[model samples]
Target: MTDTKTVLITGGSRGLGRNMALKIANKGLNVIITYHTNKAAADNVVAEIIKTGVNAKAFQLDTSNTASFDAFFTDVEAYLKSINKTHFDYLVNNAGTGIYVPFTETTEAQFDDMMNIHFKGVYFLTQKALNLMNDNGGIINISSGLARFTFPNSSAYASMKGAIETFTKYVAKELGARKINANVVAPGAIATEFGNGENKTNETKRGLVANVTALGRVGEAEDIGGIVAFLCTEDAKWINGQRIEASGGCML
Candidate 1:
């Protein structure tokens, strides 16, 4: 058997990312989470995962800024060496924030933020990480259900997810030589601290979402975490270039 697998997740200080880190740790994968400014919260997550008996660490990463990726990976490599490893096993591109602006009202800055964090960041991060990913390892890019169904104020964000879906397919195809598989995980409306906590705090919005969702409510962060963890496990080895939407049957 190989050494313990490690997963690098962006934006894992809290919310769905936090839940995913914990769930993946429960499966015996070492975890490395990135936070933009919440080092305290990120440290807390590391501590929580350590209690699960898996190795964990947190690093500062602003996913939107490509200029810092080189330095970021340098630190990651140093950390991996300290653990007697040379590469990570999986990459989960989950760092991002949602902007609630209509298409007409969306500014160039808003569009760029969405593009940088969702598409460009995922694209280049995976490119650089490929050097450090084990053969036959996998990648999971976080998309959103909005890419399938329409929602107000999400045009830019959804467009990027659509791009991710397309990019993932290409990654799977090109990386076939290396046996590195890539897939997208598109989550439906989830109740988390993400996106200013709209799904969690907007009671009227929650009522409307519940009316349309077959599951009768917005999805919890826990609902999506396990699916991500499963993809990182051996059971999902054959799954590649697939867009798995964990949206609890919403808008169906």
Candidate 2:
């Protein structure tokens, strides 16, 4: 019943997810973020958003575990009731991890991990989320530039992202009748703690990425959050089933 819009972001304890949560909150939307293990970090993000004069909370979620999603949504529903809202307005499937093993060296466990977290998790999570999402809402699926362009030792990770891209298109198509828009945002090499902070800490890797990017520098988390926030706005109502790569023209 509340007039304020709400967004649910997964893996928002840190990294790009954290940035997106904060940016979305700054746009005057309430935020519910999910964290895998870092409760303190998630709580900190919530506190920061509260200071921004928006209602924000963090919940624990293991996106890779499908069995837990039902319970997760139950908690979400209770929280929504407490806030005097029936459904959320946006869903950002952003929880993920990186594995740098080469295709030949990639173990079955690693591949399955990638599939569970990146593809399957996003797939079913979105499916279940529909019941709790408002009509005319939006879904933003996070992808990676490696999905479009090849990269050494990233075959497994990139393949899952490619699957998400295709899945997001189908979501957009099928959900159009409900007035919900689905889109994917693929970020270029970003200097975040993702992948163990290699891009942020390794000067050689940063330099290499900078050389290939048209912007002449590796992307920061700040570079990507606004794009996700924009998609949730009324201005992006017509933009559906699209893949918007925030890569600074890498490999172009």
Candidate 3:
């Protein structure tokens, strides 16, 4: 079996997840990334990681569908066997989408979607992953700046992230006996394709975010990846059950 550490990242086909996968791979960790759809894009990411001289693979997953998880893990187990490994060393719960409907206009379906994807999905996915995670492994749960500060149309999204933040602490506490660390990374408005690329393409929105951020700019995917990679390293071994906000001091 291979002795190198490996990480499993959800929604790693593009955006921040993709950046995390690449950065972690650069740190000499093998990567297993999940894509909801777009196998071509996922393959491209795997290829890019391979270029870094690290083993990488892409698997399909719908993070919102809990029923598919058991079957998905079977696939993961088979892949792990092929790699001569029994478990991965880190799990990054980064798969999710943004919903921008105003609180007054948000419907039950929107709320359910947010809850399923952001909170429920992450909770159960991590629960199931524990079987495949080695002792001393770490989990990084992706959250958002809106959880800490209000955003007019982000009520549902932000609330779900808040739930994730709290849930992460419990995970850390409960899993401490296993030496598993669970932490959350709350990123600010990053310039990615999330929410239809509003922060990246909408000039007015970009300016508004920049004005509120102490760094005077919107965050980029690159800005958050290395932090996640760092958390999986030995240097961050003692940082457990904490919410690390990577927002460039937004709304401060």
Per-residue lDDT of 47-153 in model 3, one digit per residue for the tens? 99999988888999999999999999989989988888999999999999997898899999999999999999999999999999999999999999998998679
- The CA lDDT at 45 in model 1 is 98
RMSD of each: 1.0, 0.9, 0.8
Candidate lDDT (C-alpha), each? 0.93, 0.94, 0.94
Candidate 1 Cα errors over 4 Å, as ranges: none
Q: In candidate 2, which residue pairs clash?
A: none
Q: What TM-score does candidate 3 get on C-alpha atoms?
A: 0.99
Q: What is the lDDT, from 0 to 100, of the residue 203 in candidate 2?
A: 98
Query: Estimated TM-score per prediction?
Result: 0.98, 0.98, 0.99
Q: Cα lDDT of model 2 overall?
A: 0.94
Q: Give the alpha carbon lDDT tens digit for every residue of 1-252 in model 1.
A: 238999999999998899999999999999999999999999999999999988899999999999999999999999999888999999999999998889999999999999999999999999999888999899999999999998788899999999999999999999999888888999998998878999999998889888888889999999989999999998998999999998878788
